[model samples]
Target: MKGEPRLAELIASLSLATDLGLGLPQEHVLRQTVIAMRLAEAAGLDHAAQADTFYVSLLAWVGCIADSHELSRWFGDDRQIRADSYQVDKVGLPMMRLMLTHVGADAPPLRRITTIGRFLTGGFRDAVDGFVAHCQTTGDVADRLGMNARVKVALSQAFERWDGKGVPGTAGGEQIEAVMRVVQIADDAEVFCSTGGPDAAGVMLRSRRGSEFDPALVATCLAHSERIFSGLHEVDAWSLVIEACPDLDRPVRLAELDQMLEIFADYADLKSPWYLGHSRAVSALADAAAVEMSCSAADRALVRRAGLVHRLGATGVSTSIWNKPGRLSAAEQERVRQVPYFTERILSRQPTLAGIGSIAGMAFERSDGTGYPRGLRAAAIPVPARILAAAAAYQDLAEERPTRPALPFPQRRAALLADVDAGRLDAAAARAVLAAAGHAVGRRTRLVAGLTAREAEVLELLVRGLANKQIAARLSVTPRTVATHIEHVFTKTGVSTRGAAAMFALRHGLVDAGGTSAERPM
Candidate 1:
């Protein structure tokens, strides 16, 4: 965290998020990478091949994010499907049954039936396409991170199997990349061994030899299964993986670190379509707000970095919950609340990212003692954290969600102010966010329909069907003040009922059809 951060530290930290997405135990990827390294050495792979194996093992499932929305549409929980996928060779009827069984598993009976029917007709083809996208996306990610061509090539072969039954089904037998073959064994070996011990791991490898695994590599792994897995449970996988980084020139300079964090943001946002650019939006807003608030350069960097990775924890939750249209059950809400906790845990694994994680974990912490995970109060939160919280709150409103359409620019500002009034946000932080978002703050700006700025704000919320008290809470004003504003808006707009007021607002183009005015953060 003090000097330049090494690439190993960053990738190892990212593996934690990968583990959550895979629904495997926390160090599953690290352990799999360890197994891969051992398998590489035992199989007499060259130094370069061994390195590729290590990287491919870590990144094997990273592409799962690219099609998670589709996965959730086809399968009830993408993570659960991924976790259970290890139970069998995903080819032929086994693959078909897996899809058939899980399609809309959590939905109502009628919906599930319809989903299964649709999947049988053409959805299966779409799922296969998803796999192709996954392969392309994983390769692109490796290429973007400056990985060598061997690493990217090997990763692109991720879904290939020994029997030519994997997605795309184009590569089979020895046609599959050797490095990928080694990782295939290590990946399943880690899962089986962890769940069933070394013998179970051996059984899986031998059983799938020449079908799901490379026959020669499986034989090698089976020969020394005990030696390969020895101390796996006892050793620190994180430390071991870090030590296994192949390059001596691993430290990433500041600019490189920024790019890596942005990748992290994209990785998290890719979990669901609704969140495609949420993290970057938050990061940009927070950085701009920090400048507006006159924060130190260090604080600005910290807050911005924190914003970029704030939703890393979203990987731990199922896309079903994230993409749900209706209200969440209490249990679902509890799981959602734990997202920031998971984000902190994932980032805290690497020293370079730990500080950012600490601030990012407080994304949901309220000013008054009303947030989640740890619920720290206003005094407990630092200035950077306050700014980050406010930025995240505002940006979230700017994005459309399954439950509601994107709030117009004016309503977003009003919502921030309401949070400030409710003691859930720092007033200055909220004001800075407003200003950074292109709003003119602390000024009596005139508006449409001969309405004052305050009346316009009140009118926007009212058009959205908010009650007077709700509007007051959003604007941080009293219900009486809200009533007064509404009355003035009615007098100015010549409308008495909420319906008429809404029609007028729409007619006047007060509602912004577009999302936010700020450019997306680069």
Candidate 2:
């Protein structure tokens, strides 16, 4: 609703921490952007190009996580691969060595053999080429968001090298956009500084001059290295970078901003062939379900918006887990759970986006309080969140995961309904969800003591161990209402205690055994 351009808003959002599986501080991206912008100014670029360079620098590595699946698929841990990527200069030799070493690092022999065979069959080649596609896709998103053509062009060539060894390999030196050159140096400079401070970054520029980086720009960075980097450690990177955004010739509006974010989300999802259209699918599904459930238009829009960014937290999880063909360990599962939280952290910055963030943050939460990062009980959750969570779950089920095939319609329906019966989802909301997912709801016998849809839901939660207060919070009802629902459930189900209710629900297709049906002890 704010008058700010969505492009600016996105930049503000992306300027948050890298979330690269390391517990690094937030604003890592913003700090890098600041360094890149200052380096551009030092390089004597014109005001227009500098502005273009500013955004390019901020978003240059925004797509870094796109190839994470591939990296993790071939290598054991995607974050380690990225950490190592920063240390290498030439792409080919280092990559070959890294690939050979990591081929079967943590996998079984057969799995490793399969990965190696695939890599030899051009999988590695495609993975490398993905970098270029990432740039093009990123630039395309910027173009769609109404950014100037110069910025788009600069972003498109962001991965190009001076020696013509980069993706697309078409532009170099003067042919490459000036912003691209500035951003390239800025990108490496941040890594070097993080490794060895400003002096190391300067050395890296000097070392790569005329090969990986523009010699002139490197010299410019070297000349003003001290002044450009002065006090970089002092100011908050996000605020400084945001304040330094070259004021656009014209202010951007909210609609334009949303379009821009959609583009970015789409591009981010395109990093891997598997993720090609996942974000758009989730967004559409979430929005459709929200409308089908008769949610307010504003709430519907919020769900759609949250869907676009629900996977932004995917940046924090290692791509290895995302693309692995085997099961994830407990540690890996915990890492995966952090993604929704990461999305929340990024969106929570802008107050206007608070509702969107709140929904996005709970995309992984279940009504039974079994979802990660927070095991919120039924009454503690929100309806919008419940819908978002269900939509996301259904979408993921429809997609191919690392360790499983896409769920068939019948299986997907049964699984979803099981969650509904298990107190992990709202019954009315689940019915709406099933309909949205194209499932027919024929007349069937009541599953739990002839409980109505709402009553079944209350019973499911009661079995799950949610206290009246927590149930009220999740259902957006008062504790007294929840108590009344519980009393009715007891009378109807002939249950005397929560334990008995849980047994009856579980036995009668009302709950799952994942302990997800039961709320954790308060």
Residue pair clashes in candidate 1: 418-474
Q: Per-candidate TM vs. native?
A: 0.84, 0.75
lDDT of 2 by residue, 217-285 (tens): 888888888877777768877667667778773455655545655654554453333454466667767
Model 1 lDDT tens row, 83-138: 88889887878878978888888779999999899999988886787677677667
lDDT, residue 103, candidate 2 = 70
Cα lDDT, all candidates: 0.81, 0.68
**Clash totals, every prediction:** 1, 14
The number of residue pairs in model 2 that clash at the backbone is 14
